[model samples]
Target: MGLVRNRVGLPAKCDLQIKAKREVCSFEFHSVPGDKSISQRAIVLNAIAEGQGTVYNVLRSRDIESCITILRQLGVRIAWNGDELSVHGQGLRGLQAPAGRLEVGNTATSARLMLSVLAGQSFAAELGGNALLSARPMDWVVQPLTDMGAVIEYLGAKGCLPLRIQGASPLSPIDMEATVFSAQEKSALLFAGLYAEGITRYRQRCQSRDHTERLMHYFGIDIHSDNDVTFLKGGNAFCAKDVMVPGDMSSAAFLLAAYAIRGVDRKGSLLIKQVGVNPTRSGFIRLLAEMGLHLTLQAEAELISGEPVADIYCTPGTRLSSVLAEGNGRIQSLIDEVPLLAAVSAFAEGNTVIRDCGELRDKDTNRIQTTAGVLKAFGVETSCSDDEMVIHGGRPLSPAIVNSCGDHRIAMTAAVLASSLDEPSIIRNCGCINVSYPGFVEDLSQFAHIDVLPAE
Candidate 1:
């Protein structure tokens, strides 16, 4: 099957209407989509396992769909029933050489992780992506895999996408320290190490996301992590098991920010059900709670597929205080949610500063530049250096036109900022929101005065 465009786009025709701010007390509850991080990892692990397995509640967004399409092209059989996904594996060595190029449209996770999986196979294949995906840095993954005996050549840009990879059998294991803090890079090494001849050890300067490691342990792989170091044994086999992906915490952050700012005036409480509150991915929740928002964990946490899942309960709060986002370790946890948090900071009681976030420059767009521009469009005073953003909160915001920069998180963040405005505003390139949350506009409309209009 060919990759599908989820929505059409118009340059200036589409306009978002943001009604005047009012007390929104109507009762609101929503079940967001499955975690994209977990869904992507589960699909990869299941495809490489020794037996068939079912993954329940998988996210059905562009990113997850890209994983499905790429896996199918590599000769893996995957069946989809509603939100349940069944994968029939051909073991670690079972993937056949694709008849043609594997297209991963705009999904960095799929491109990076799958490159590692293909490194150990005894064939040659080319991986290509759309314009946005082609610009993202692949050297972080390529250099490591190349060091371990994989032959990877750049078909286009030296360090970018359109790669030609020749599989390396009996891969060599190496002891390396990650110069940059990236879970994708670390995961790529670990995945390739699964097929190596010996143990592979990796130490990170700061802790990155642990979804890959957790999923590995869930599948019975011999993996362990202590401090900032991780050890994985090669020549191991994977046994598939049933996995239930919880609601994405990143997608849930927009709702939490909405209620945290507007819920106090509403008559009912706001509850988001069964979200994956993995510590590595829960920085936004913790930061908001620390900012004096009445957020709480309502149920005991459950461990599913090595991830922590729980129900999140939030009641309206009177005000929000500023919090600092610095340090290498803490920034990696909330990296994706910084734009949302920056938008929310416009109405806080004090100035909010986010530092050690230069990595934002390397996303689908320059998030640091786009986020500051969006805040400025809404009449919020913001300033940014190379790796830091400072928002002077407690300022009045005005209705204005903003741009999404074709980034999904930027589009969602703009929508949230528009909700609290005194009048309506427009957000350009809003259709790109489907990359992560296809139901974002529909779900938020149930609780806020927001409307999605097609380009005229």
Candidate 2:
């Protein structure tokens, strides 16, 4: 049989099988590239703004590149010089309708966020993506846009993608109530509301990440929130501003978990300098502390960018404890870290149960199941239902080959397990690690001895 090589030249198959006995070793990793989430937003916002916008330290990943492609298709002038990106936008309400269909691949953020901007236009547009992107829920955007008078149709599953949106008369103000608190949904409504008749009000169960609201304020747009409602007035023009995208806390969780499991100094603790510590996205930090992991945050000095930057110092400590739902809910602010946090749980002393993460189940059940699968391969007992994964720890993981299931987080978690194992193990679909951390293998090489063996 032949091996499969992915776009980034990662090994086709990553299977972890014990070729020898277990050996313990430690290593350190450096910082990763610019944040993916911020990169997507930066490109979209720059495309919609009036003047030239400069984005420094932008990530050039698949998802972010999808956003850049959509922006360019809509008549924006975008240039990239190394890590610096320059986008010349047509200002609010500046985009001319594209002559044909605009395809945004694999990235739901690109499809959803850009759809909102498209809603305000006096033209028609169709949005489609890769199989996975088309499968993601779009009713989140459909419901609000339809309520505000935008015409949209789901070409596939009821609320899912393969969307055909015919731009309508600019939206009328909406006193909207959301069925779920999704940042993409909220941001979509806010973008569509920019061309509405009056003030558009957003009400949801709880607050989401708030990147949209914060960026609104940054661009001199009129926005306000009270209780559970956020308001955006129509007839507003957003000014282009230079943005400094910081390191992602979500990405930082991998390094933190590696440090906590393998002993930071023993494996050489990683320093992720000047990462975005947006309170909404720091739940992992809080949850780790609550679970009794030792992590130090330094350089809390404020930056001119309106977001806080800090140095993260993490060292391995005693087996961390499980988090309760009430506490987990408090840190639900950073829900994306739950999967990697499960890996940390596998190395903990007691049962580490994760609940109130039902939202995650809907997005990547295959990936989550892969986490449980990897844990089982390493001799960690785990129980997973639709919503949560319960782990029983304190058992040293045995060396075994596992699958990454085409998920980057899963690939990295498997790598972490491989680092602490004495025997050579295989991780199938290891190429998935390129989705987020492109240099993951190189960084992981610093921690443990890993061979890029070809698949059978």
Among the numbered candidates, top TM-score falls to 1
For model 1, how does the per-residue alpha-carbon lDDT over 1-456 read when each residue is reduced to its tens digit?
A: 111212222223355666534654543444678899889989899999989999998888888888999999888999999889999987998998999999999899899889999999999999999898898899988998999999999999999999999988878998989967878888889999998989899999898889989889889999999899999998877788889998899988987876665535553576777788888888899989888887788774776676888778877665788889888879889999999889878888889999999988889988999999999998899999889999999877888888787788888888887776557887777767878888776666645577667754
The number of the candidate with the highest lDDT is 1
User: Would you estimate the TM-scores of all the predictions?
Assistant: 0.95, 0.90
lDDT, residue 220, candidate 2: 77
Instruction: Report how far residue 198 has shifted in candidate 1, in Å.
Output: 0.6
Local distance difference test, candidate 1: 0.83
lDDT of 2 at 123: 80
In candidate 2, what are the lDDT values of residues 167-281, reduced to their tens digit?
A: 7666788887877655767778888888787899988667677777776777777888897889999876777778877777776777676666664335434466667787878
* N/CA/C clash count, model 1: 3
Q: In terms of TM-score, how similar is model 2 to the real structure?
A: 0.90
RMSD of every candidate to native, in Å, equals 3.9, 4.4
Which regions of candidate 1 fall more than 4 Å away from where they truly are? 1-15, 20-23
What C-alpha lDDT, on a 0 to 100 scale, does residue 213 get in candidate 1? 91
